[model samples]
Structure formats: structure tokens, C-alpha cells
Target: MIAPAAAVTTVPRSVRLGYGVGSFCTATVGAVPGLLLLYYMTNFLAVPAWLAGVVVTAPKVWDLVVNPLVGRWSDRTRSRLGPRRPWMLAGALTLPVAFFLVFAGPSLRGVPAALYVGACFMAAATAYALFEVPYKAMPGEMTHDYHERTSLLQWRMIFIGAGTAISGVLAPAIAGSQGAQGTLASYRMMGLTIAVILLLAMLGAFFGTARAPMTGAPEPDRGGWREQFAAIKGNSAFLWITVLACTQMLAVSMMLAAAPYFAAYTLGDPRSTQTLFAALVGPMLLTMPLWVRLARRFDKRGAMILAALMFGGGTAAAMATPLFGALYAHVAILLVGVGIAGVQLLLFSMLADVVAADAAETGKRRAGVLTGLWTAIESGVSSFGALIFGIILSIGGFVESEPSRPVRQPESAVTAVLIGQTTVPAVIIFISVLITLKYRLRPPAAPAPAASG
Candidate 1:
């Protein structure tokens, strides 16, 4: 049931920016691991491709259980800091330290190193959920106006662009450029720098949202997981959107996991990973307003379909890079970046609407639980990208090696990276477009008339 926009007082500029900067946490934590972790394990830790996939994936599957639990906990928490911020604070404190340790470990290799990375990655994933699940729920609580949520998430997308640029472009440069992909010091430097970025962004969000107004949300107690599942089952909009977004995430994750391999082996340069990231994220810095306008004109679901087409087209076009060369790949990725800007902005904006609509209909505080379930599914689905790519690498006979002992991969392995990054992701994205067609959600009721007094 859609609720009236309920005369939502526009969120303050300070609070909006404060809330917006939180994506720094989301983007960095989301990007760094996908961008670097798989390659890091394969090249530096000497973990075989298939086991490395398991190490990356198992921790995220753990989130399928943990994230929803934290969401439910925050939904019930009572404090001066509010239900969400307290958990945000907790994640801010723990994730940076755990992230640092994931890369800075002893010079262990093979299965032992894989185990160490898995444990630390698991801890980092837990910490991320503490901040992310609750933090994502805030926009739904911040304002009820449908258009206003779009405005608010615009600020967030800007920060997301910055965060992704740092993680996607700068992190790779630090890891691969300073020495090579084979240098322990290079990977350590990459880990430390990214950790510091995570700390600053997470802390900034915790403090920035101090003054934002919280519209009331469902305060349902932990009524057990089955009840929670029942609530999710009943929200059609929420279910459809989650399915749509998770499919999109799987596509993005595959691209991130295969990027370094694609650059080093297919494109003939390791440093090209940095340039590829720049092309992928650069348009985002300037395109949010255009996306917001598209949402206003076409509605979010329509805009999402258009964006999906662009993304899928770009991904498919890039498959010709080996034939057309790197310049063509960069241009194709630029189109993907423009599409990414719209999709990223609209996905969360529409999500806020779904949660807010559910709150109005149910009269229960299930934002945490709902967002928890959302995060858990998104994280778990995304892990499939890395896992699938890892399997591809194994089947293609990609060789694993330590930093000090690099190995030449087979011609088949290079082809595997190419197909994984381009053809597979393109197919997944087209499927998401089909899912988007099913997500015919109503926008929130139009804003109530304003008073002049």
C-alpha cells in the first residue's frame, strides 16, 4: 500500500551531505575486496584459483545469516545515538583494523594464507554489515517525499563515485604500479591506504548524520527468523527490487573480479587496470543530475530499464576489445560508466521508497530486518561472480604463484578472463533487465501541498 508523501520536511543540507558521505564506506568496502582480493590471493598468497574463490565467497555467505540479525537488532535498539548510528559506530571501529590485517599478514602462502585471508575477510564482512545494513535504512526514514529521496541519494552517488575511484583506480595503482602485482610491499601499501580511506569515510558518516530527522519506523521486536521471512515474503516491491538489484550486482562483481587479469594478460599491461577503472567511474563524477532528471521524467523503474540496456550493451560491445583493441574497450567502458551512474543512483532511491512504503502499510519497525535481508542477499549473490570467475580460471588452467614467483598463464586462461569480464556479465545484466521489467512498483504518493505560513 502506498502512503501519502505526508508533508515531509525537506532534509537539511548539512544532514543530507552527512548522510551522503556514508557511501564512502559502502563504496570502498564494496569495491576494494572485489577489485583486489581475488587477484591478491591468486598472485600474492599463492592460493589456487578455485580455493581463492571459496575464500572470497564463504565470508559473504556468512552475511546471509548475520546481516539480517544486525538489522533486526538495530531496529529495536534505543539510544541517544539512535538505532542505526550506534551500529554504524561499531562497524567504523572494527572494519578498518580487520581490513588492514587481511593484506598485512605474514608471508604465508597456499592453503594457510587462504585460511588467514578467509578469517579476516569474514570479520571485515561482519563489520561491514554492522554499518551498511542500518546505514542503508536511514534514507527511508529521512523523508517520505518520493522526489526528495532522489535528491538525497544524488549526494550519495557523488560520494560513491569518489569512493569507487579511489578503490578501483588508486588501490590498483598502489598495488600494481609501485613495484608490480608480485610485490608484497605493493599489496601491503594498497591495503593500508584503502583501510585509512575506509576509516575516514565510515567515521564521517557516523558523525554526519547526527542531526537528520528520523520519521518513525517499525519497532518490531526480534520475532524469530521465520516471522522475519514472512514479513519479507509479503512485500512484493521489496522482493522484486532485491531480485533485480542482486542480479545486477552479480554482473558488476564478475567485472571487478576479472579486471586485473583482463588488463595484465589480455590488454598487455597491468597498469591498465587503473585506466580501465578511471573509464568505468569517471563519468559518474558529472552525471548524477542527469540521472536524477531521468528518474523524475521516466520514473525509477523506467530509468532502470534504460540504464540496464546501456550497461548490457556496453558489456557486450567490450567483448570485441580483443579484436578492436584497448581504445575500443575504454570507450565501451565509458558507456558502461554512464549507465552505472543512473543505476547506482536509482537503485537506492527506489529502495528507500520500498522500505518506507512497507513501514506505512505494516505499522512495524522492520527496516533493519528488511535492509538486513537486502544486504545479505546482495552480498551473497555478488560472491557468485567471483566464484564463477574463479572456476573459469581453473578450467582454463590459470597458474597461481606467490609475489616472488610469478607464473606465465596459458592462452586459454587469457581467453577465460576475457569471456568472464565481458560475455558473462553482459548476459547477467540482460537478465536483470528482465527482472526490472517485473518490478513495476508504484512511486510513493505525491507530496502533500505546501503551506505558505
Candidate 2:
């Protein structure tokens, strides 16, 4: 069956802008906790390092249950507003409130505080699930055009990159200015701001793309969840993609966890944190157009493979910290960041094809279910990433707020940090590249024609 709205192609420029901005808001709210939550819990909130890891991991475990369920439900829902948009609207409001509570949670001074924080995190996780699952599903449903999907995502990443850049740079500055309880207050402000952004995005997507057609329901599945799992497991493309996604997520967590440490200890300059982060994401903003050109020239899979290799090579180069100055670290990370930039821009486009192909093969529109499962995996990976990094740091003997200045550690521990950020991810990225190569996707025999620019 021809997909609805397939005859017409190319989303309006305004709609694309709206999607990009909305995505930015979502990414900002989502990424800050990933970037700062562990540090905040372990250092600022005075939680035990190990316990902080638990806090980071706990909510993600819920995705194992929540993500697939939401996806399945949305797929089954019959709504006037469209299946995905409703969830996005609800999540848009819910996310910011939950986000604020996560940081504004009761004092972490006692057992009550820990319980309070956990509860707040649980709430935010639920909201994120609501917001993110639908947000992710929209791209697949938005347009059937393959390159259109890439274009949509390209803009989305632009916004997401901008949002992450703002939050990453500003969160620290905002928290630092607030003094003792300032982080808490800063979080509240950030949450409110992010909420506004999400709301705007929701409206734009809801209204701008509201007229866009839904693929409607998928054909019946003979079995239930068990069968679904079996199908996905049997699909080499999906399986490998999941493996690659998980590895990338783990690697991302490792890099984020180690970045601050790399700056402070290896470079002996705490101020370098801002500089490094800026360098990492700043170019993404400037280079997004070029990234788009490269993606179009090569297509998503080729782009992803190339990106992975670049990241891996750059990561390996980061190993030469002693051999080169801080500039080496900056340049290596920037290269890795560039590779990530391309991957981030294209991975979802590939997934859209995977979902569509599965539907065509099975006659079942299980995008929501599949996406939910994907969300569960993505969230789980992110949470696990945090946990994994914490374990790495703990094992490396890194302490927070040492009673003494210039706290000394065995050289081996420092080496571990470097490896965690560089080599470990590089290795995993290479494996992911291998998985992507193994994936064999046959596009529609007669694909739709593209619109002229």
C-alpha cells in the first residue's frame, strides 16, 4: 500500500525549523542530566559515588518495561490529533516539571533526601518516556521520503546540538553563580525554560505537521510480545543496529564522564572544561550544512561508517596526551565530535527505513512498538552508560572534593581515564561499524522521485 502523504514530498522550511527548535528544547532538557547529574549527585549533593551510580541507573531500568508498552499503545491508538502528537503534547509539559523536581528535590543530607531524589528521578523518567517515545516515532511517520527523513533529522540535530551546547555551557555557569544551594535553583530555572521550548515545539509539530498523514495501522501480528521479540531478534539489520546503538551509547557515556576529569587532571586546567565542550559542539553548529551535503552525497549508512572510523581514529589519537600538548586533546576530541555529528544526524534516518521495511515484510505497522522497544533500549543504554562510567571512576580512585588540594592518584588510574574517553569508545565504535556493514537493506524496488531543490 502506498504510504499516506507519500505523493507529496519535502516538508516546508517553517515546519523543519519548528521541528529543529522543538528537538533542541527536548535535547537540552534530556542531555543536561546526563552530562551533569552524576557529577551533581556524587559531588554537589554529597551522595556516595557508588550510590550515585545506582541513582543514575535506576530510572533507565524502567525503560525495559515502559518503552515498548508506550510504543505498542501508540500504535494501537486511534486519535484525531494523530497517534504520536498527543503523546508529544502531554510529554512536553510533563518533562519540564519532572526535570525541575529532579534537581530541586529535597536536601540530599539524609535518608529522606535520597528517597526524595529517587522519587523525583522516577517521575522525570516517566515524563521523558512520554515525551521521547513519540518524539522519536514522529520522524518515521512524518514523511515517507527517505532523503526527506534525513533532511528532517538534519534540522532536528541542528536544534539539538544548539540546545545541548547552551545547557552544557550554561548549566555550570548558572550553578556556579548560585553558590551553595544555587545548583538547585539553577535547575528549577533551566527546567522552566526547557518546558517553554518543548511546548513551542509541540505546538509547531502538532499544528504544522498536523495535516501530515499517518501510515495508519499495521497488519495483524499472529502472536504477541514473544513473537515480536523473536522477529526483531531474527532480523539481522535490527539486531546489529541495536548492538551498534548500545555501543555508541556506552561510548558516549564514557566520554561525557571522562571529559571533565580529562580537562582538570590531564590538562591541569579546570577552565578547560568549557573550552573543550564548546570545541566539541561548537563546530557542529557551524558545520551542520556541510554535514548535510556530505550525507546526501554518501547516504546514511556510508556516512555512519565513515563517521565511526573518524571517531575511532581520533579517539586513538587522544591516547598521545603526553606526547602532545593540550591542543592535541582538543583536536582529537573535535574530530571524534565531527564523526559523532554525522552519526547523530543520520542514525535515525536509517532506523526509519528499517521500520518501514519491517512493516512491508510483515504487513504489520509496528513502528510504535518497535520504536518503544528502541526507546527502552536507548534509555537503558544511556542509564547503563552512566553506571558504567561511575564504576570506571570509582575503580580509578577518583574522589570528589578531596580534603586536600592536588590530590594524587597512581598513574595507572589517570591512564584509565584517558583510555575510557578515547580507546574504549574507539574500539566499540569500530565494532558498531562492522555491525552496520553486516546490515543489508534493500530499498523499495521503485523508490519515489525526489523534489528539486
Candidate 3:
């Protein structure tokens, strides 16, 4: 029989706040690449659209191997600080250096520059995996209370929204300017600024959770990697949740990748992209508590279904902006933000419960392995979003131009941008809702008692 979980009954607010701050690091790293990397490669570095796609997508292939290993490694580790904190600390120190190199590569053009940027980004991706997998695992390790897990993740989601908004607003405003070289300089400056913020946020999480209680002992050495893989294969709930989460992640990534183009081509002003992004993300902060309450009152899957409908309806309404003007589009985007908030808050919370349930069934806590797989799928699919949008742009015959010389897109390309920004994500969100319905996980239960001798 499975043993009862020795989970911390109450986590301090300070610890929760500290953990929540780590989202700032994740959001800054995630947002910068999704929001600007494709634009940087094509517009500033002058790489072809197809090549830009390859460069951005290639580095993430590393995560498929690294994430699982890191996850398992942390599971086996025994440390003075904790199994996860060392990885978190190491990631905190190295990520800033990698972030700086991503934008500050030597002045080279064509394949050479693409190679340099790709190599730098691979390092950044590694650092992110090291931090993100362990950090995600903590929610399961920190508490076993089903409702409390949702509450903890709610704070993280709130900060995620805030951090996304900060990066969305600041990166564009900093990078907006006159010429190609000037724009490059602006990106470099923005990179450095974001790097500092990432470091500080990560450090805060490391120290803040230093004394938080751990739930279970590390699993004893099993057969090998095959055994580890087998563990994940048996968890049907985790598999379904991964699919549902990955679809939402891909949709969000595609929208982020297409936002600048949509602003330039459809809204007729590139600067407006930042404002649109802010509109899309700001409401998430205010709406997260409501989402958390909904999840607590009903169920995460139900909340996700509601979110998907809202997101699809909002996206469809935004597609009609050409007829009604930018004001109508902004309101529609706010609704999308609300939907995104619900999805983000509920998905991770649900994953924590899935992990707890797995522990109950198997009598081992392998949160790292599960969280690793989760992060790997999330990173891999999101990166592919860049490639998908790139193919769309290439097929529509998008015009490539330097910052100093703006080019007007043909109607076909403009239409492609609009479709990418709207219909694509709306459809993906609906599919995610369908997948979520298949997820069947019970709430946390007390362990059954051992039989008498």
C-alpha cells in the first residue's frame, strides 16, 4: 500500500512570494526569445526567413535530452541547501552570461552569424532547463494539499503575467528606433537589462525557499534510464496533461512570434505592437485570482474549457478589427488575456496534483522526471511555433527590409499575418480544450493504512 504524504500543511507567505518572483526570470527569458528573436534574426541580422526558423528551432533540440537528465539527476541528489536549489543557483549565475551573449554576438553576417547566435541560444536554453524543471517540481514537493497547490501556483501565474507585461512593454520600447544598427544597439541594451533582472529574481527564489520543507526522500537507484522512462510511460494523466499544456503553449508562442508583423502590416504601426502586447497581458494579473477561485470551486479542467472558449471568441473578434478599427481589437485582446490567465494558473496547479497522485500510486516521488518532460515538451513545441510562422511568412512572400527602409507587404502576406495572429491560435485553443476533457485525475486522498501483522 502507498504511504501517506508528509506534506507541509502551511507554507509561509514570504516563501510563496519568493517562489512567485522566480516567474519573473522565466517570463523574461521566455518572452525575450519568443517576442524578439525571430525579428532580430530576420530584420537585424538579415538572415533569410527559412534560415531564421532553422536557427531558432535548432538549439531547442538539446532540451529533449538535457531536460530529462537534469530532472532525474535532481531527483537523485541530496544536498545541504536542497536537491533543487543547487541547480537553481547554478542556473541563476550562468543564465545572465548566456542571455548577454545571445544579443551581443560578434558583428558577422549570413551563416557565420547564424551559427554564433544559435550556439549562444543553445547555452541559454540549457540554463533555462536547469532552473525551470526543478522549479516546476517544487510545487509538488512543497505541498500535497490539492487546493493549496492551486493557491501557490496562482501567485506564480500572477507574477508571470506581470513579468510578461514588463518584458513586452520594455523590450519593444527600448528596441524601437531609427536604423538597423541603432535597433541592434537597442536590443543589446535591452538584453543586458533583462539579464540583471533575471539574476536577481532567481537569487530571490533560491534564498527564499532555502528553509521550505521537503516532502519525500530521493528515490533509490532503479534499473536505469529505461526504468525512468517507464515511470513516465505509465502515467496516463500526466501524458494527457502534457498534450493539453503543449497545445496552449504552442498557440501562445505563435501569437507572440506573429505580433510584430501583425502590428506593422495590419495596424499600420510597428510601435503599436508593444501596446497591443501589454493589453493582452495586463488583464491576466487582475484576473488570476478569479481563475484560481473558479478552479477551487469547480475543477481545473472545467476552468480550462471556459478559458479556451473565451480565448477563441476573443481571437475571432480581434480578426474583425480591420472593419472596426484598433479600439475594437484592443478590447478583444483583453478578453484573450483573461482566458490566458485562467489557463496558465490552472494547468500548472493541475500538474502538481497529477504528480501527487503518481506518488500515491507508485510510492515514489519523481516530480523532477515528470516536470522535466513537461518543460521539454513546452520548450520544444513553443520553439516550433517560430518555424511554423516563418513558413507562413515565406509562403506568403513576405518582404524583408532593414529598419531604415520599411517595406509594404503585399495583400497576401498581410492576410497571412492576420490569419497567423488570429485563426491559428483560436483553432489550437479549441483543440486544447478537447484534449483537456480526457484528463481524469482524482483529488488528493489520504493514504490507505497498512494491514495488521
Count of residue pairs whose backbone atoms collide, per candidate: 3, 2, 0
- Top TM-score hit: 1
Q: Candidate 1 residues 1-453, lDDT tens each? A: 458855775999998888878898888887888988999999888899999999999999999999988998999999999989999999999999999999899989899999999999999999999999999989988888888889999999999998899899888888876565647887888889988988888889999999988885646645787876887897888999899889999999999999988898989888899899999998778999998999999988899999989999999999999899999999999999998888889889888888888888877778888889988998899888999999999999899987667778889999999999999999999999888888766765555689989
Q: Model 3, stretches more than 4 Å misplaced?
A: 1-8, 177-182, 217-221, 445-453
The pairs that clash in candidate 3 are none
List candidate 1 stretches off by more than 4 Å: 444-453
What is model 1's C-alpha RMSD? 2.2
For all predicted structures, in order, the TM-scores are: 0.96, 0.87, 0.94
Give me the candidate number with maximum lDDT. 1
Native-to-model Cα distance after best TM-score fit, residue 234 in candidate 3, in Å = 1.5
Show the lowest summed lDDT stretch of 10 residues, model 3: 1-10
Candidate 2 clashes between residue pairs 3 or more apart in a chain or in different chains: 218-365, 219-364
* Candidate 2 local lDDT, 234-302, one digit each (tens): 877777667677777777766776676676568766456667777778766776777777767876677
The true-versus-predicted C-alpha distance at residue 446 of model 2, in Å, is 4.8
| lDDT for each residue of candidate 3 in 254-312, tens digit (9 for 90 to 100) | 88888888787888777887889889888778988888888867777788899888887
Candidates 2 and 3 compared by TM-score, better number:
3
Q: Model 3 TM-score?
A: 0.94
